[model samples]
Target: MEVLLAVVIGTLYGGGLYLMMRRNLVQLIIGLGLLSHGANLLIFIAAGLRQGGAPIIAEGKKVFLTLPADPLPQALILTSIVISFAVTAFALVLFLRTYQEVGTNDLDEMKETDT
Candidate 1:
């Protein structure tokens, strides 16, 4: 499972980078999203995949009887998801406005127009 997840994370990172190198603004935004997702997954996998109980102590228990799942990565992923979503939305809106004003989605064309 870990190996599979590693492959998936690698793929996401690779695809994201590949798309980001394209000349299309839309593809760049998509690549950014993919890269964020890959980072989230990497954090999750780095925290370790274990079959354990929730990270909560039972009532009247001084300590956990079983291994508890790490909550830090989960919290981090959630926070990152929200951040990525906001960034992507903002980028989309900005790109859309630029497209409307510039009449092009190609980065090369946009750059050329700046001259």
Candidate 2:
């Protein structure tokens, strides 16, 4: 089960990176989203695969049968996701504005031009 999850996460991350290298801005945004999901999944999986039990700690709890999830990784992934979203949004807006100003979506065509 862990190996399956790892493979899935790895594929997503790899595909995302590949898409991010594409010339299209939309594809890049998609890649960023995929990357974020993969990262979140990876973090979740890294917390350890437990059989059963709640993660919350009750008052005066003696012992836990199952391993508790690592909250730190989840927190980190959340922050990273939010930051990635902001960056992706900014990039999309910039792409739109660039299209409006330059009249083309082809990045190669937008290369520095001489007057």
Candidate 3:
């Protein structure tokens, strides 16, 4: 499972970078999204994969008798997801405005329009 996840992460990073190098503004935004997703998955895998109970002590228990699932990674992933969504949304809006003002989505073409 871990191996599969590693492969997936690698693929995501590779694809994201590939797209980001293109001249299209939309593709760059998509690549950014992919990169963010890959980072989230990397954090998840780094935290370890296991099946365990929640990270909470039982009633009147001094300590946990068994290993509990880690919550830090979950929280990080959730926060990352929200941040990524916001970034993507902002990027899309920016792209749209740029397209309207510059009349082009191609990075090279936009440069030509610069005064």
Candidate 4:
């Protein structure tokens, strides 16, 4: 499962990077979203994949159960998800405004106007 997740992470990162390098604003936004997902997955995998109950300890226990699931990654991922959503929304709004103002969706074409 870890290996499979790793492969998926790599693929997401690679594809995201490829898209981010393109000249289209829409693709770049999608790439950024992919990259965000990849990062979250990476963090999850790093925290380990266990088959235990909650991290809370029992009455006589000093710590979590042997191989208890880590909550940090979940928390981090949740926070990141919210942040990414907001960022993506803002980016899309900016992109749309820019497109409307510049009358084009191509970054290359936008550069020509600066001259």
Q: Could you tell me which 10 consecutive residues in candidate 3 have the lowest summed lDDT?
A: 106-115
Per-residue C-alpha lDDT of model 2 across residues 27-64, encoded as one tens digit per residue: 77788888988988988888776656566666687776
Could you tell me how far off, in angstroms, the CA of residue 99 lies in candidate 2 after the best superposition?
Answer: 1.5
Give per-model TM-scores.
0.94, 0.74, 0.93, 0.89
TM-score (C-alpha, index-matched) for candidate 3: 0.93
**lDDT comparing candidate 2 with the true structure:** 0.81
Best-to-worst order by lDDT is 1, 3, 4, 2
- Clashing residue pairs, backbone N/CA/C < 3 A, model 2: none
When summed lDDT is taken over every stretch of 10 residues in candidate 1, the lowest stretch is 106-115
Per-structure clash totals for the candidates: 0, 0, 0, 0
Root-mean-square deviation of each candidate, in angstroms?
1.5, 3.1, 1.8, 2.0
Give the number of the best model, judged by TM-score. Answer: 1
Q: Write the per-residue lDDT of candidate 4 for residues 6-114, one digit (tens) a residue.
A: 9999999999999999999899899999999999999899989878888888889787657678888899999999999999999999999999999888888877658
Evaluate model 1: give its TM-score.
0.94
Tens-digit lDDT track for model 1 on 24-94? 99999999999999999999999999989998999999999898989899999999999999999999999
Pairs of colliding residues, candidate 4: none
Quality of model 3 by C-alpha lDDT: 0.94
Which residue runs of candidate 3 sit more than 4 Å off their true CA positions? 112-115
lDDT (Cα atoms) of all candidates against the true structure: 0.95, 0.81, 0.94, 0.92
